[model samples]
Target: MKQWKPAASALLAFSLLLAGCSSEQDAVSKPPATQNKQEKPSQPANAAAGSETSKEIPDAVKKPLKIAAIVQLSIGTFSSQYAQGLKEQVNEFGGDVQIYNADNDLSKMASYVENAVSQKVDGILLDHGRADALAPSVKKAVEAGIPVVAFDSDLNIPGVTVIDQDDYSLAWNSLRTLAQDLNGKGEIVYVWVGGFTPMERRNVIYEAFKKRYPNIKEVARFGNASQNTALDTQSQMEALLQKYPNKGDIDAVFAPWDEFAKGAARAIKQAGRDEIKVYGIDLSDEDLQLIQEKNSPWTATAATDPADVAKLQVRFLYQKVAGEETPQIYSVQPHLVQKSALPEQKVSMNDIGKYVEGWGKSDAAISAWMETLSKEQKK
Candidate 1:
């Protein structure tokens, strides 16, 4: 099986790095009565069909390719696992990978992208930044013949591909689950931020969710994304708990980001408000542990493995390098994980697939040549 690992570092700013945070949307949203299969990572059908000879390969796709991964934040285990997958995939193809984390600074992230272009790296993989901050650098990289692939950022530049975890669907899945658990009526706390593409999309779904479940009310709302996201979130959640000291004052926390989930869960547990549930949108080793803990308030989350996401991003980058036709936008599918399904005996992300169907690696963006490259690398 392909090795795979979110909770991006869990808040990715948990959608924009949080300062003070806050959104609305339309259309009543509900889960499909019959769930559809997760879509595979996609590319042009022939994107994978490369000629067999070594001479057929391009220098850009060749081994020792120098690549840069510019990330907006790297505070959590989710980010570390993502980097691990990237290195793992790049290693299979034999390349030099440099990952730069901006510590939630958009300016630094932009600079890192510019630096990558100046260095003439073969490819750039970007995560979580604003369009205004990143578009110019992304265009620069493309103009220099360096392929740029982004995850959770808005870059409309031609020749750059954007990958996302379908945050709207992710949020809806978890929110829908929460609604179902509460029988469509409950008071919820919203932990969120803005200025992120993923977060915005999720917010769209959230707005729809509220419209659909008019009975559910948002009692308290608070969130921020920072270097100390979990800690800050925990502090905020604690404060909210104090404001609503009575049991059942907050029925649940809709933290579409894993970092927010972690914080809310901790706060609820610490306050001995085990009755409040947390519904989140990303997962990691730490997240899984929390969800599985005895009476963890964090009961459910929707996520795709970050490592698998990293590997697919690398594959798409390589595909672009090979002069293949690739899609402009690709979404990594997410799966709902209920704490009740996970084994209590300690399991890692790599092994949790058995417990959660569609939780591990995917064929998204995978090509025959890519598989061939992996086999070749093994030799």
Candidate 2:
């Protein structure tokens, strides 16, 4: 074979390099630019394992827990409304709430508290029941690591939180309205049902009225009576009216609740004293209807939003159970509602009485009221 020249070998080497580069370019150009479907490799094993672990944990275990509510009485529009509110809020927050009604029996309330403790409830919401009566049970539960929250009625006991209405303010404002309506002077007959929070509020109102309005005289102080016992309230009212025959002297009658006001209204009507102004606490739909009907002399009422109070109490309890910080006491503001302030159409007793029965009978009416209430709240 003839010996190859150095220049020829170098040129051959250059040609081979060019051929390799051209082949690579052709391979790249062969695939469609828009049709490339290559997938990037997945995350490393450690990161993938961590993500899987995170997803396996259940939310219930990671988040807050259950609550139990104890109520004083099973009946009445205010209590029922509050219970409904509490239930709705608890359901919304992904928590369990069990409500127990003591039926106005203190012993029953104590038993319910004990039962709740034994059940290992994460928290408790006490409504309109004496704190002192349930203190032992509450203390035991707290020692067992469960928290207690009180609403409407408070014990002022340590380690227990209270959420309540400004009773003193409510009393002051209500009496002031009565005084103004009576033109700064009148003989006022006061009636109140004893037990729970209202009794305390009644006492406050009486004291404040005496101090603030020397012109307003207390014509009568009636004892504790159930709201449903209209006969008893009527008897008491009649007795007072008989004692003070001159209707001109009695300018107003003050009742602590709507039902009591109803009794007073019946007595006032029977006595034919339409000029006497009637004022009371609680603006239950029944009372609202009474106000709207204009049949009764119930001109104004000092109203506390029990539903809002219940919701706030439940929210505070939820935070405590969830290991979140919250206020020791949450106060619900009260309003003074007059009949004139209500809607122009004026709902009838026949229509609103259906709602006063605890959202049980009339679904449509309850829904409408709830919607209206929601709108009012937003405003």
Candidate 3:
């Protein structure tokens, strides 16, 4: 399909340049859910869509459209894959894309947004940032006629389009499975974070879940970090285990993010508490392995294909940049994945496409738009 290959020299140069900007954060090199540079790159579900070249590539798409892709963190595999998708799609479409890693630094995020406006980039892709800090820059971009597409960002700007993983559904599906597994009666720990859009949305459901399952007691609550995520959470989980040492005291855990789930699972395993099950949101090749393991406490998760979401965000940006009518707010749906349903072997992002059907395809409008572009090629 559409091939987007980054220039080796340019990537290397960018890496070197970025090296000085922020200290290298430790990357959690674990799998069934995270990224490994050595693993084979899996084709996306919509790979076929890229095979046919448009006979008439839009002049806007043909010219190397400059894009400023900014992210909150690069330490985790999910975030990395998300960033990777944006870069690859832009490159494949013959566009110039520069990724700005904020390392989850709020001030840095603001700086990048302001810099993008100053640079007069054709478009800006804001990934997982706070709206309060980004509003001014976003307003500047809109005033300058620059399109900005936000993924999991809380920015409430008038012109910018906001896209997000259906956080409520992701939590509802996973928690429903957990409630069923527990027969709706158990003491569970709640691990969550505030400030991020996706987390905030999921929290809404978390509150609803508590109200619905009145018997499921939330004995404890926790949060996550933008750096050394898994490890930090694991350490936090260890402390939690110590506080609630009795097996019967903590029957289950609801860690909405995979990283938090992973940490909770690791802590449970280390404490030799196999009976306590952990449910989470988000999955990857790395995450699948953990679920497939014998006696693994991580029982289930809900997720969308991060790679697919990333690529789709880029496509949306392209369409908007080309004056296509897209929804002001686009939501990607998620699915529940239990441990029993996981493949024995580690699964890549490609394999996940089946579970999350139409992972990146937002609506019929997107497909119809593509069809129009295809017919234009013939004309």
Candidate 4:
């Protein structure tokens, strides 16, 4: 990435713009009806239209806006994908983003936030950390006038903007599919691990599921896939299968995250229980392969293209720093993927980019900004 430095004139102009622009410019201004809901459109966003850059093309934008992306639990592929989006979006907008992995350690995450503040970075993107532990430092950064956008963290701090995967909708869409598959009555096993904000939000829907469909009995609810999540979950699935050897005892498995769903599918396959179906949240090339496999128990999922999600987050922060309006809470909407929807040929996550159609790009505040950039480039 090229290094960016602002000219004195550019800095002065940007300061003026920031002072005058309204918050509406930084927000998801009157998103379409389907946005924020669980509904997936038959057609995806138009990738061919391309993402636009900010209009006006302030000289300050030519100066790279330095941002620190502090992430919690950089262990899994999903996290890696999310980071990919962040880096790609910042680079697209001529900004430099340095990602600080917290490794799921609260203290490290807290310290990273403080360090960003001390360094006086242009902005900070907090990814997947506990709000309780990081709120104090987040408050300090916001009070200091540093724009902060959090992804998957339930930080209720007044000034900070929050962007999430719409966890409740993601869960509802996937679980709802599973329920329909079972005709609303069956024995199901829920694989989940608590502590993370996204998971907690999904749990809220899980509790709601119990209330809404009392006929669906949750035979077993236990999972601890923290360190080696995939392997650990596979082991847990094996144990669950042993406890309920009779195939008829369990009709379906609800593993909100793909890792758990993969494990459960493997265990069911090994146990010759192909009858059990697995539904989950989040999808990737690997997850798609499992779903497409013949006789595979992994059925369907609700997900957002992680790369698109990351870019949206970066754009939100960029808009904030650019003196544009932003929203308090933005939901990167999800789409449902069933086994029938999988492509016949083997493909990677990147291949799905065209199909997902930029993952609802126009609904994002950044889309409007990008439109200005496109027109400017044409000039």
What is the Å distance of residue 241 in model 1 from its true position? 1.1
- Ranked candidates (lDDT, high to low): 1, 4, 3, 2
lDDT of the candidates, in the order given:
0.77, 0.61, 0.71, 0.73
The list of candidate 4 runs beyond 4 A from truth reads: 1-54, 350-363, 367-379
Lowest summed-lDDT stretch of 10 residues in model 2? 359-368
| Candidate 4, residue 189: how far the Cα is off, in Å | 0.7
What is candidate 2's lDDT per residue for 7-112, written digit by digit as tens? Answer: 1332243234345433432332122333322211132212211112222323332344578899887545666677887887666555678898887887889888
Model 1: how large is the Cα RMSD against the reference? 7.5
lDDT of 4 by residue, 1-379 (tens): 0001111222233234343221222222123343323212221232111224535654545467899999888756777788888887777676789999887788899999999999999999998999789999999999999999989887867657687776766777888898889998999999999988888777866776776788999999877646578778888888888888886799999999877887888888888898899999898767877777878988888888887778878877776776655656656667777776667776667666445433444245444555554454445
Task: Please tell me which predicted candidate would have the highest lDDT against the true structure.
Answer: 1
Give candidate 3's whole-model lDDT.
Answer: 0.71
Worst 10 residues of 3 by lDDT: 21-30
Put down candidate 1 lDDT per residue, 201-247, tens digits, no spaces.
78866776787789999997878878888999999999888899998
Candidate 3 Cα misplacement greater than 4 A, ranges = 1-55, 353-379
How many residue pairs collide in each prediction?
12, 0, 14, 9
Candidate 2 TM-score, C-alpha based: 0.71
* Alpha-carbon shift of residue 1 in model 3 (angstroms): 20
Question: What C-alpha lDDT does candidate 4 achieve relative to the native structure?
Answer: 0.73
